[model samples]
Target chain A: MLVYIYDGSFPGLLTAIYESYYRREKPEEILAQDQWQHTLFAQEVVIKTDEKKADKVYQAIKDKISGFAARNAYCVFLAEVPGAEMLIYNYLSRGWKLGAKLDFHLADEAVLQVHTVAKKVRQEAHRMLGLVRFRLLKHELYYAQIEPDHNILQMISPHFARRMADQNWIIHDVKRGLAAVYNQVEWVLTPLERPKTISLDETGLFYESLWQKYFSSIAIKSRKNLRLQRSFLPKRYWKHLVEMDESRSRFAESSVLSPQSPVKTYK
Target chain B: MELLEKLEILANAAKYDVSCSSSGSTRKNKAGGLGNSYASGICHSWSEDGRCISLLKILLTNYCIYNCAYCVNRSSNDIPRAYFTPDEVAKLTVNFYRRNYIEGLFLSSAVITSPNHTMELLTETVRKLRNIHNFNGYIHLKAIPGADLELIKEAGSLVDRMSVNIELPSASGLKLLAPQKKQDLIIRPMDYIKLQIYEHKEERKISRKVSHFVPAGQTTQLIVGATPDTDLNILQLSEKIYKNYELKRVYYSAYVPVSEHPKLPQISQPPLLREHRLYQADWLLRFYGFRAEELLNESQPNFDLELDPKTNWALRNLHLFPVEINRADYETLLRVPGIGVKSAQRIIRARQVRAVTFDNLKKFGVVMKRAQFFITCRGKYGGQISLENKLLRQYLIAKPKPIQHSSPYEQLSLFNESVPSIPSEVMLSNLTGEL
Candidate 1:
């Protein structure tokens, strides 16, 4: 059995795909260097990433197959699921043969597998778009920490860059030690660690309190369904969400006047 | 009032309005702007009640002039009243948006002085958010029913979506519950917004430079179980509203009994099951191509408590069953009980490459338990027994639970019990006898 191994990068995977065709040998497994396990009887080939070769494969996928197929390959690479490298290789191998009709062949197991994995990656990115909660830092830098299931920092940053064009923000993916940092102009993905001893300014605390109050007050007590809430915003994501912090009891008294309290009528 | 206190009161007041969707508007962020609108709306959080908190839904004020029996903010009620200035609302929206806590603002209001006065305040809040704050986020403004057309039009152009709640399903219900609100007064703004949206679409076709007017289109809410309106009445009214106004959505909020009025029904819990059924039937009307008359007639005024509207329809119309999976058209496949829009489309796409066997149906996301009775794979029936309506319904009726008074609010677990397993072979012999 022939096993192909490459560094765990999108370009590295693409370069490996290009080499497979140039070498004219179908490997039993395509794996990242870290994920490859040695087998006593298997032959191993290490593929170094070449930008030129990677670009050829990417452009061919776009020009020959379709832009959608190219996007699916990129998203599946970002998914980082086990055996994802082999899945994308198999998917693209068929894509080269069938051209644009590859995705339409949903009956094909490899084609269906590629579409499903890509969809899951895209869905996670879209979910993270809403789940991210930014906190105001001292220097007016907005910082949000997320521990998403997938490596979606690059996928969702373009959305925030467009939405928060006037502000500087950093979306830190705590799980992957990656961050998409934006400075009112453009964004760049870089390795970042969880900041130690993070502090919130006075207004930051004030707005956080206000948001927590709004979140709890917005829920109707009679219709409370924690099960349904968990289904949408899972408990796993509750760690970073400001509104979901259990330490800050939503029912804690902040004022003498409750929501049910009668106030002086304004007529 | 402190901002926190005001939000607590106002958000609690606005929780009854169930239209929290921030979708269908593609408002892009301008240069140096603080935010943009997502075409498919994002839910920042899910509240304890399981509803998506997409936008920061709040009322400008809870102070009112006219007393509506169903409204918590009605003048006769003694709830705490508070109002946010236009600037304060805009500032709150920008701050929350900056923190990525909400998609945008869903600004509603009670009639503080008059409908026109309240409309002006709502309009001013959105205008401040758009122009002064340079915030291009999704904004859904509630259109005051009796407000002037010019005021409504101006507000519509500024916001992503606008809505005027129909309040009650029937005209008599409106008269009984909210006497000051006439039927025509409630509908006039809706008509005007509909006309303006249609006109804006035509204008955009001619020139791309034309600005959007209610770009997400208008939606409205009808309070269920507040009056004696039947499921038929509600569905028929929704059909008319969809046809006449061309609304993007019609939200059906189960009447949460807030105020105890002599005219109101003395129900302890909100009729959530009924509301769920209405939403299911409404989905059929909108997406599944089912008509109101087809789902419910004069003989059946209410939806079946055990079966969903689609399953119920399929059971009643048994002649259309055992549809050939490979040959059935998309519309015919959609009529199957368990085949939804996504799975039906999947089946169509899958069949283009290879014939879909019954074993392959599950992979395509088709629920075989209910669909087994209705669909065929290569002229072979999947159901164990013959396709008799009575026998099929016996297998299909959802487990009977306490319908009205359940407190934990469990979603109806449909088809929980396993059906008789499909036999391994010899199904073609009974294929002719089954149907």
Candidate 2:
């Protein structure tokens, strides 16, 4: 059984898909470079990232299937799940046979997995539209910091750019060390390193206090439910929230974090 | 007072209101403006009670002339009273919106001195937000009862959504709990807003830009459990209003006991479960095409605390069950237990290509555990055993221990309460997505 491996990049995975079709042999599994799990009796095939080869596979999917289906395949690849490379390969192979009608085969696991993973990315992107809280930096830039589980920076940035069109803002994906910067008129994505410190200007600091006051005041006193609060905004997100201060998180739970409870709290 | 202090008092005064949705408006961002609105409202944060805080929901002032027993801002209550100037409110909305702290302003107020005086200030705040600040975000304004119709129309013109809250479900409750408020005073504005919305639609056909008059339409609220109104009475009233007013939504706020009144029940907390059940039943009325009389009669007045309203209805009407999956129409499939709007649509879409089985239906979003007893997959039955109606209810309604899987120590705290297993198929009629 052959196991295909590629660099942990979406185009790299697409190149691997092109190789499987070129070889006329289906790989048993496809894993990322760092994601090898030591499969017994598996012949490993390392595929390099070639832009031309990846473009060939990309054009085939886009030309054969509708653009919507092609975009769905790309998003599914971005989900970055362990065996997503092989899942896309299976989906594309089926798509080439049936064109745009391939997505209608929801009963097929390969098709369903593509839908599920793309949905996960889209859902997270929608959630980030609300979860992002911009801070007023001393230099008068509206900045927000997010450490999302998925690489949803591009997905969520367009929304902010449209909404805050006149304001110069930067949305930093702290986990991936990338940023989506909007300079009043247009927006662009660039690589960013984690900043050493983030200082809130006096106006930003004042509004944060007012917002915290508003947040706490709005909660119905008779219904002090930490469980429901944690369920919606989860613990891992609390560190970034101005109102959900460290004290609130500490008072809500024990030292030991439960897995079922929100996935992340503090770094 | 500082802005923070005022926000605390004003938000405290406005806490009883449960209309937190910033939906139904799809206004896009202007060329040099601040924010826009999505059709499905964005929830920035949820409060401790699991209520979505979509908008910067606060009052313009906590000061009031009328002393309503149920209101925290009643004149005699002597709570810390603060009034935000129209400029302050406009700036506050823009600031919070720019920071992504809120969707927009849910601006309500107590009747200060007079309804006209309070409404004029509220309308001015929104007008300033739009004209002066160039804020194009969503603004949901409350139509003050007994205020001038001209002022109400002006406010409706500026804002996306307008509401006149029928705080008490029944007129008698309004007379007893809120002596100053009359039912006609509230209904008049609602009727006027509805007529204007109808007129605007007709006018928009002639001219595409008819100023988008109350473009998101009107909504109102009913404070449940505050009066002796039964679920039947509440649902009937809601049904009547929905048909008559063409209102966007009817918000149900479970009455949280704020002040002591001789007539009011001294319950410690709001009737959340009942509110939840009513919302579920309301969903049935609006979307599922079930009527109030069908769901509840004199024999069954209140909803069962254990079973949801749809499940309850399905169990009673078991003769309609075991529907053939391949042939069942969309409406019939919807009546089956656990078949929601999304799943029903999925089933219809999937069946267009090929015959569906348990595997296909599962992928199609059907909830099999509840739906199994009701549906058949091409003449094949999945149920291993069939019990009598009584035994089946006992099986379905029994609470599976939530803490058993975690550990024994989970039993020590009641805060680790058993969560309702249902994903709450019920949603607000106006809102598109689940809460």
Candidate 3:
């Protein structure tokens, strides 16, 4: 089986797709050279990183499988899963033959793996849709930060761009250090090396107080099942939730108000 | 105060009302807004019991004058109560919206001072959020049952959606459970809101102007298992509400045994599976073109808890089975067991250019295990079944007999029974003829 290798990049993966299609002889495995180590009885082919080849391969997949499938497959590659290259290679070759019908039940191992990876990426995309909390910056740019499990920077960009088309926004993936920026008409992604910083308006504290008060008021005291709440939403993610901010200030004030009684209530 | 303490009192009160969803609305923020509504609503985080804490589903106050037996916040229950001011609510919404912790507000309250007094407070809060605070986000306001029509109308104008819960399915149930509330009190406000929405829509067509009606439409909640009401009775009420009021949705909240009450059922947990079946039945009524009478009647009060509503219906009506996959219409295809909207749509689209075989049906996402007995593709059947037998009806809908060993005493003792009993083979022999 011929093993195809490319630099660990989305474009480079597209270049590998170009080589696999150009050579009519299909291989048993496709491995990235960086991830590939010495293996016995394996025929290796190094694919030169070419933009034109990558674009051609990308266009072919879009025309053949589906535009959605092409994008999803590219994202599955970004997940950096072990044996993702071979999975993509098998998926593409079979996808061309099966058309849109390839998504349903099948016996092929590669097809199964691709389906699992696609589902995982899709799940992450959905989570980010709800979790990407945007904080308004002083510069009128709606800025948000998230640390998602997958590289879902590009997956959620179009949704916000279309929905918030009138406003300027930036959603930075803290873990991946990438950002999706929308300026009126369209959106673009770049390495988030220098994000636009903003000063906290004095009204920020006021808003926080109001939110903490509301959160406290709305919560049902009788149904305060902490075990159940913690089970559904872990305390680990509580730092990002703004309603929990009052506890810090409440701690600072509790010493002055109570000399002996325990600070039982937060906010 | 401990947020936990407040949450316990308020949520326990709110939990009984049973309308905790941020879905079924399609509202976007206008210009100069910080947040927008998602078509398929956003669930920011899930609560401990796996409930979606999407919106801050809470009440303005737990103090009510009405005596509703099912409600923990009923005037009869001497519990500690709290209320949030209009400014407090608006401020809360803005902060929560900014943090992406909530989509908007689901503000419900008991009739604190009076119907008008509570309605005014609720409307004031929503108005402040929209006009004073410039907060344009999704808001679902609960209309007080006996509130003045004008106040309810004002609330409808301010919020995206409004719900007046029909807690009991029957007027008799209401009389027994909540003597203070009347059927007309709940249904009238809903009727007024419905008419106002229509009136606004009709006026907007003539002039290039927009009136903020209840843009997301109105919904109501029905508390299940609280009273001796059948599924047929409940669904009949739902059908009436849907047809007459033009409701966007009817939320069915399975009754949870919160307090040790003599009137309520002694259920250990909420009949969630039954509620799930009702939701499935509701979907069938809304989307699948099934009537309420077809699924339930006076004789069969409860849904078949063992089987899903669609599958149960399909099994009972065996004559409709073995439908031709390639030729059946969309509605006909929807009637097939185990076929959801997505699967049916996939089949219809995939079979447009080519004939479908059993193998091809698998590719179209048909659940082969369940669909195998129900569909034929290219004159080929996958399961062995006699289609013409009159006894198939008996085979399909027969309820499984409870095993003698399954008794509570037997379960607790965990001891072998020496009593005379029907043998396994004998039981199978008896059931096989019925099947």
Candidate 4:
């Protein structure tokens, strides 16, 4: 089995896809530089990142199939799954053969895997639109920090820019160390220094308390469903919410409808 | 009064209006505007009751002239009343949107002084939010019933969506529960908005510069379990409203008993499962191509709480079962128990290349547990038994978890003798079958 390794960048993965195609042999796995494991019987190939080679493959995908297919590949690239590098390569090779009709091959494993992985990225982007909480910084720019499982900063920024067009805001992806900043005009992506700390203003604290009060007051005391709340806005996303501050979650514990009865109240 | 005090009363009054969606409007942000709307709504937070909070749902004022019996803000209730000026409401909306606390504003009100006077306030508030404040966030305003048509029309053009609640399902139910709110007064504004929405589309097609009216269309709420109106009556009414008004949604708010009217149920909790079943049947009517009359009838006026509306419908129509997975049409595929709109489309696309077996069908997102009994894979049966026996019915619906006896006395009596205890419907059905 031949295993190909490359740097952990989108262009690097596309270059690896190009190398495996000309090698005329199917590799068992495509590994990022950090993700490689030593196996006794496997042959290894190390590929360097080449912008020209990656561009050629990307353009070939758009020319042969459609730009829509190229977008599918890009979304899958951001998924950052362990072995997505090879799956995308195989899917595109089949696309070259099928031309614009490649999307019809939903039964193929490589095609279905890319579609499934891209769907996860799309869902994460959609969920972040709802879950992102902005804090008014002392500097008066709206600042929000998210640590999503997927790298969805680029996908979700356009939504905030369209909605919060008149305000200056920054959405920092803490896990990925990148930020999408909107300066009351167009948005720009820049590298963010990790472990970013923000100081909240007095007005921000005032509204935060009001929001926490409104959030707690709106729920019906007779129908408290923790499991349902956890399913929609999971525990992982709770830490970022202004309403899910530590005191209220503890306050919520004493207000469970009934600790014993799990039956939905209806006949 | 403090902002917190006013927010508490207004939000408490507005909680019963269960239309929480900030969806279906494609309004975009202008150069200096504050926000935009997405086609599918965004939910910012979930409350402890597991309800989504998409918009800052608050009443403009809780002071009222009319006393609708079911309303928490009725004049006889003796609750504290508060009002927000138009400037205050618009500033609140812009501030909340900036902090990502809400998608937009859902502004509703009681009949302050009179209906026309109240609607003028609502219109002024949205007009300021759009024109003066330059806030383009998704606004869902209330269309005050019996308000002047000019006021409703002028407000409809400024906001993304408007709703005039039918409130009760039947005219007699309206007369009994809310004596002052006649059926004609509620529906007249609805019809006017519907016609304006229709006319705006025609106007937009003729010239690209013509402004859109109520771009997200209209929606309304119907209170479930407050009256004798059955599921049949409610669904049929919603069907007419959808067909006639081209309504975007018909939200069902399970009656939370806040008042002690003699005609209403004296239950401790809302009929939640009934509301859930109504939502499922409503989905069937909207997306699954099932008509209202087909799901329920006069003989069986209510839905079965044990099973979902789709599964219940499939059980009643046994002859439509065991559809061929490889050859069935899209409509027939949707009728199968586990095949939804998404999975059905996936099946149509995937089966064009190769024959789909039951295993492959699972990959397309068909719930194998439910679909196995309703479909055939290349003339091969996947289910153990067809829909010929009652066991199939029992297997499809999950048995409710047994009731826990947490009290000490009830637990102590368990060791005394043979306790012929039936904790759930599953056990009761099993015991009756044995006898």
Greater-DockQ candidate between 1 and 4: 1
Name every residue pair that clashes in candidate 1.
none
Kindly report the docking quality category of candidate 1.
Answer: medium
Q: Supply candidate 3's per-residue lDDT for B330.
A: 95
Worst 10 residues of 4 chain B by lDDT: B407-416
C-alpha lDDT (0 to 100) for residue A128 of candidate 4: 94
Between candidates 1 and 2, which one is better according to lDDT?
A: 1
Give per-residue CA lDDT, model 1, range B359-393, as digits (tens). 77887888887899998899999886668746778
Model 3 C-alpha lDDT per residue in residues B1-435, reported as the tens digit of each score: 544445445655675555555666666666655556666677776543555567777778888888788877777787888776778667767766665667888889888878999999999999998887666667889999887899988888888889999988999999998889899888899999999999998888897466669888899998888999999898888988999999989999878666667777888777787888999999999999899988887778689887778777887688788899889999999998767787788678657645767876665567766677788887787754555656544544456677677554533344756543668777788989753
DockQ of each: 0.63, 0.53, 0.20, 0.54
Task: Pick the DockQ winner.
Answer: 1
The docking quality of candidate 1, as DockQ, is 0.63
lDDT of each: 0.88, 0.83, 0.73, 0.85
Give each model's clash number.
Answer: 0, 2, 15, 0
The candidate maximizing lDDT is: 1
TM-score of each: 0.91, 0.89, 0.76, 0.90
lDDT of 2 by residue, A240-267 (tens): 7777865232222112211122221211
Judging by TM-score, tell me the better candidate of 3 and 4. 4
**Pairwise TM-score winner, candidates 2 and 3:** 2
Candidates 1 and 2 compared: the better one by DockQ is 1
Give DockQ: model 4: 0.54
